[model samples]
Target: MTERSNQSVRRAFKLVDELAENGPRGVSELADQLDMPVSTVHDYLQALIATGYVTKDESAYKTTTRFLEVGHRQCHRLEVFKAVRDELETVAEETGEHATLLIEEDDQAVIVAVQEGPDAINLFAYPGARMPLHATAPGKAMLAHMPTERVTDIIDRHGLVEVTPQTVTDPDVLFDQLEDVRSQGYAIDVGERIAGMVCIAAPILDKNDRIRGAICVCGPRSRLDEDRRSEIADVAQRAANVTQVNLDYV
Candidate 1:
């Protein structure tokens, strides 16, 4: 592609991302935020509208639900997601906590499915939520099973940013903890990503022991004492195992 066309593509995607994140916006507002000229923003918005990816209401332009269609199609294409969809609900109901399925993409953990038990705490996590792989139990669970080179690459790309006081920000410390995860067959998060929250996760592996993704249960620390954490860990691991088995039959 020509340099001009490539720049135009990047600008167009940026405009769509801004609209998706911030909701409806006017031409001047988008131009100001993207540091582009008003006419350019207008032209991009017009092209997006023509492609049915965006819509305008009066003077404000917003992304259309067409994006949801695209995301939905992409999500279902993952075999692991389909295998674990119903199992996550079972984990949540069994543990009375939040259950989530996460897969690594672009060096980040993306939530593919989530379920809340009757007594589950609200963590504001939903499908498609992306988080650093070093900051959450499921992310760690998946990372622990990956090759050392891949893990190092991910750490190099996105440093171990401290999300909370408990987050491991040192590469050596994280590698040591990953060793524990491999031996124990599960990963733990104690107020790492968010204060007062605790999580336990297990990696799902294929027949060849390749890491597919992870399943986790999360709850408030007050509700997840040491004993309770152990119980949830067992449950999460069993859920992950079931998903792994289902992957073979499906």
Candidate 2:
């Protein structure tokens, strides 16, 4: 595509996202927020309305139910079971801690599934939660399996910003930790993302050996002491392996 075409597409995406976030905006409002001319936004809105992705109501434009359908379809397309929720539930039961499944989406680690553990300790992760790839256990689990170049690119783009005092802020230290994760077949975050919380995660791989996502068990550091780390790690690995086997990716 030409530079102009690419810029137009990017503008359209920004407008749609603004509509989704602000809900039902007029062409002038969208143009003002996007810093584009009203004429350009109107043209894009007309095209989107014609495509049935955006709907016109009186003088305002809002995302149609099509976006909801698209989101559902995207969530359902995961190779995991149609009953993937059950996987987290079982993991929570087995591990007695919060069980979460996070996937790499749009170059970020997104929590796709979550189950409250038996301990009832509140954790921050939930479905739709997004975290940086350099700070969290699930993120590191996925990052370790990616190529070194891709890892460096992501770190360069996102930077190893410290989310907490324990978060790895140095790229070199994070790379060394990734090597350790690769060797151990799992990753750990001890207050790296959230203080006082510890997470153990393992990568979920597809049959073709692609790193599909990650499964994690999270809880207080007190409970996940040296003695229980192996136990939690074993459960996380088992859950990931089972999830990969059962994933029916279309």
Candidate 3:
């Protein structure tokens, strides 16, 4: 945790980021793009290689397969999503809405799985779809449980553009909403991200009780207004708990 060590790691990460976007590159190319000394870049690259985060091929350095494997493991080993599939199906069968799972990646919420509810309504989410962290219900639920530094970084990168009349575009308000989510144990999007769509979501906690992912139910706004929001929240929370229990076995 020393300043010097942190700086070195940061520099190494920057080099990796450059290589990631620019494809494989030689030490000189990385140094030039990062504006760091060639020797320094080489040292960091070597360190990355040692940690299996990067691999050197003759003259070019690229990200290692290990990083890919690690990401893959994290995605699949997500306990909450794994645990709640059957329950989500049941919830969908009973409610006839769409049930979904979302996970945070690079400060954005990505849909990992979805189940169609019995109501037979059309919905926007599917696996691999990305949504703004500040706009979607699952996005806000995940963000509400993340570290402040991580949340601030995302806000700094992607400004809170108003996606709908209900979207909170102010950071202060978003922060306050996060607090409310923490207290209430879930988040609701009543047509905040998409017009005429209502979403209710709850955080999926891991074995460590950390926010690992989120489970949600979505349907037409007409069916999930303020009067029925509590009912939707109840379903979401139950599904989330089921997902958490599943993660324990995984």
**After superposition, candidate 2 runs with Cα above 4 Å error:** 22-28, 55-61, 80-85, 95-97, 116-129, 194-197, 207-209, 219-231, 247-250
Give candidate 3 misplaced runs (Cα > 4 Å): 1-78
Q: What local distance difference test score does each model get? A: 0.93, 0.86, 0.83
Best by TM-score: 1
For residues 65-144, what per-residue lDDT tens digits would candidate 2 score against the true structure? 88767766877777653435667788899888888888898779898877887784877565677889889998999999
Query: Candidate 1 at 246: error in angstroms?
Result: 0.7
Better of 1 and 2 by TM-score: 1
TM-scores of the models, in the given order?
A: 0.97, 0.76, 0.68
Candidate with top lDDT is 1
Q: Candidate 2: how large is its RMSD?
A: 3.6
Clashing pairs in 1: none
**RMSD of each predicted structure:** 1.1, 3.6, 6.8
